[model samples]
Target: MYAATTIGGGLGTGLLSFYLGIGVAALLRTMFGYDAWDRDFNATIGYIFGLVGWLMGVGMWGTWGREWFGLKIKDPHANSRKELGWQRYFMFNVDHKVIGIQYLATFLVVFMTAGLMAMIIRLELMGSGQDFISNKTYNTVLGMHGIMMVAVAVAAVVGGLGNYAVPLMIGADDMAFPRMNALSYWLVPPVAVTLLLSPFLGGLETGWTAYPPLSVLTDSAQTFWNVAIITFGLSSILGGLNFVVTVMFMRAPGMTWGRLPMFVWSMFVTAWLALLYTQGFAVALIMVTLDRIAGMGFFDAERGGDPLLYQHVFWFYSHPAVYIMILPGFGIALEVIGHFSRKPLFAYRYAVGAFLGILGLSGVVWAHHMFTAGIPNYLHGPFLVATELISIPTGLIFLSALGTIWMGKLWLRTPMLFALAVIFNFACGGVTGIFLADVPTDIHLQDTYFVVAHFHYTIVGGEIFGLFAGIYYWFPKMTGKMYNEKLAKLHFWWMFIGFNLTFFIMHWPGIEGMNRRIADYPESLQTANLIVSLSAFLLGSSFIVFIYNFINSWVRGPAAEANPWGARTLEWQTSSPPPVENFLTPPVIAGHPYDYGVPGAAPHVTFFPPAVGSPAGGGGGGQ
Candidate 1:
């Protein structure tokens, strides 16, 4: 049954739908005299419909479509194979584990693709002139890289680790809406296609923000980018909704609010932030698309549209979007800290409070991004105060992390090292952000390499570092194999050193008056540009080590024990890769989710003894 809806089916159906849509649009234009629409308009609509077809052809209909029509159905047995085969990942399987791996694998490819584009950008800037690619091509590459990496930062952890670990940690067999979860994931591939396909439509150069007036007037490819962003946003919203429902209503029998793992709590809070704020960005993009396709005057300044209105709306979500990216990193870091340090989470309640505080403050602080754009002078002080105040909640995260590792059994594993690096990098990001928050400092640094360095430190250094930590920390459980520790450490040091060396020096050029988004720069900035570019190349190459370690370890490394880390989370209470149903039986919650350092602390959960000959009875269950 599942064979019909393979990856090939998805690609074929999507391509057929796209061509069919173009054909129908052409017919309408020629035969029916509907000549107002151009090829770009038709292409945009075609891509949207093609995405629908792709999802339908990817087997979403099997799990969700039949049930939607009230059809009584038997189990499709999609993931019935005891061994986790690679094919299940290619098709739509309702298993959370499969969905998680799908998200991770898909976005890692996107991340590396974007990283390659970054390499091109760095290479172009290396000689301080048009050495390689044309300036037009550079802008397009920069825009593409920005949007693609934003998609990765937004989806990789939440969609990947959040999907795989959240359910098991909460002792739920799966998410509350399994089909919705799968649908959210299936929505991403078409987005990737649209982003990559845009250059063919004449390319876009407005950068990831796509601020209109410029966006309203750019190449028709902007239409493709618009649709891609809207699609990705929709996927994010649905995924967030699933996390909220699952965490709220799906915990095990004795699991309670206070006892939830810090990571789960972060996910819960992050889901609400995603649910509430993502709509603003989505609506902003839709309005811009309408301006392009329907002549809607929402952002057209000549049409009496307010360009700044678009900025207001974009940053309304984008600023909070930063929090959305970093909050999970915070949770993952703290989770690693507690386990490796062999200590209870320091100031657990305060950390949770800080999360809540960050969420509350996020919505009001959007105007800080607009300080240099001539936002009301009267409003400047308030925005500055609001932006500066956010550090208090953010500071709690660092304090908790440092306090947890203070004088404890600090295990400097790959994950812990990455977690520690997150602190250093994020501190750099946070301090620089304070400068950007102040109107005076922002007037100096806005749109410079300083701005770029600041955000990369925050997002790449903070979120990506945490992402690596979570991946290494959970690799044992996810793959049921121990990664090569030497290679892993080498990957860590190479990336960490390379990342800092690249971005850290970028501040000097920014302070010395180097503007971003331009391919060429002054002769005086040449030496700095050369160094940064070379450092970036080395930073980019470190992932080669990571990719090798991930794949090699998965295929040939030693088998992992279920409770290799001896953490007390519910996920660790199950098998290394976990059973198809997650546990031998529904687990009975035993105590707090993180109870390290407390004498005689109980295990977080205990599974019922499996019936005779069950997989759990065969020793796949946790210790």
Candidate 2:
């Protein structure tokens, strides 16, 4: 029956292996006469072992790992393969759709968790000094909120929506490496669990950046935080590689690059960004970890190590990591806009070029994030120019979106409304970004609430809006059911109004000398603080609507038509909720996806097998 390989078995084995890992590290350290009781050293080693155990326990060992040692791999879905409903999602099933749903569901929980932390932060800041929690507690909450939100922003769209849609869009049976795809998703839970457990081990005080000497010297929680993020970065890199490979080699016959859907293009660029640039964060954290566990002097001033080095490494990844997050958001927004606008995508090639442009420019703009961190004046001009210059490509996306909407028959569904908000919200974020990109203004507003406002407007306004759009747009396809349109719209307007209200006022306080990352502010700012806090609660409450709608609709909503949007994309040609192989017949791309109202356009896809031994696309699905 293979009853032991479900999530339950994974948890049991994970706990056992976690203990074994810690105990072995302690034993080895004792033999070497090192500090066996050292929390940082032991925890770091223990986490590595725990991560592996968890992955194997969750079904990887039976399904994939056994192949490494000449043993037959067991079926991952043996226990519940016959039932084939909810239980399959709990194990390491190699279905891209299942993995996508897992990623979405997991990260949605992470998003809400972080959002609640944000409200708690807003609560503390609503008045002044020492409202409830101490400064240390506030910092921990802030850091937790920052990191978790960043995680949600980074993975939710690409892992969740990208996984589910890309293969189907490209007309492939599954990802090029299905087990590896499953592996990337499985890596996520350990990262999340490790991060959530850190506060109990003295908490993470050093914000998401975890910069330099403070991170190097903080308690074991920082160690856990570092390890968790490093694990997350690995997941990102692997997922990126998988996406790059799958899109390259796994496409249907005649699914040429130019004919690829906009969302797929966005993800293609994002995947490259992830594969190539995620190393910046991983390397930075690894140094921090080595410094903590091995007594390395990577950032030790006494040992002539440069503290500024860490900032450089971290932001190098962290900044482009912004694009890594937002590009997919834009991708989703553009996609929904295309289908709902009932018009051909405007400047399609230009939009694709813009994606490539962002990819080319993303790595160079990393230094802009470090301007106020003490860099040479000579370096400032180049970074500022580079930072602002990247906007040209992004601006093309805005043009493409607006152009599609102009003079078109608008279907303002929940997804479309949310998609439209991406442009409106990101326009504001982009304008504020100019101030921060300039050297003088950045020096003044470096750690202020203005930066906070701009950051959220860009990520939450632009990307989070895009995230919701993707959720709504694909809900019918993914669940084989329709959502409540009325409830969905209610959530959209409430969240839109509340989000703008909360973050827009947040900019005023920054301009008025309210430093960010603070638990306290002057009494003069109390009124504005209260308004933002109350608005934040409103923003938080909107998710309740979303949660209820998402659950109720999925469980009891009307069955959806396969081609609900009447779009030309290959995915829509398949059954709603799709088949195990994605298509009853193999799909073949015929022409571009968004040829709406082109009078005599070829259908985007047709059913046929791929040519035998096609060279296919570049890149692989492996990490």
Which model scores highest in lDDT?
2
lDDT of each: 0.88, 0.90
Per-residue C-alpha lDDT of model 1 across residues 161-194, encoded as one tens digit per residue: 9999999999998898887888999899888988
Q: Model 2, 94: alpha-carbon shift in Å?
A: 0.6
User: For model 2, how does the per-residue alpha-carbon lDDT over 1-623 read when each residue is reduced to its tens digit?
Assistant: 23345777778888888888899999999999987788887787888888888888888888888988989877643523536568677778788998899999999999999999999999998887778898888889999999999999999999999999999989987887888888999899889988898878898879998987999987649888888899999999999999999999998899898888999999999999999989999999999999988989999999989989998988889888899889998999989999999999999999999999999999898888788877888899999999999889989999999999998999999999999999999999999999999989988898999999999999999889999999999999999999999999999999999999999999999988899899998989888899999999999999999999999999999999998889889999989989776887677778779888888888888776655654355442376
Error of 1 at 116 (Å): 1.0
The clash numbers for all candidates, in the given order, read: 0, 2
Which candidate number would show the highest TM-score if scored against the true structure?
A: 2
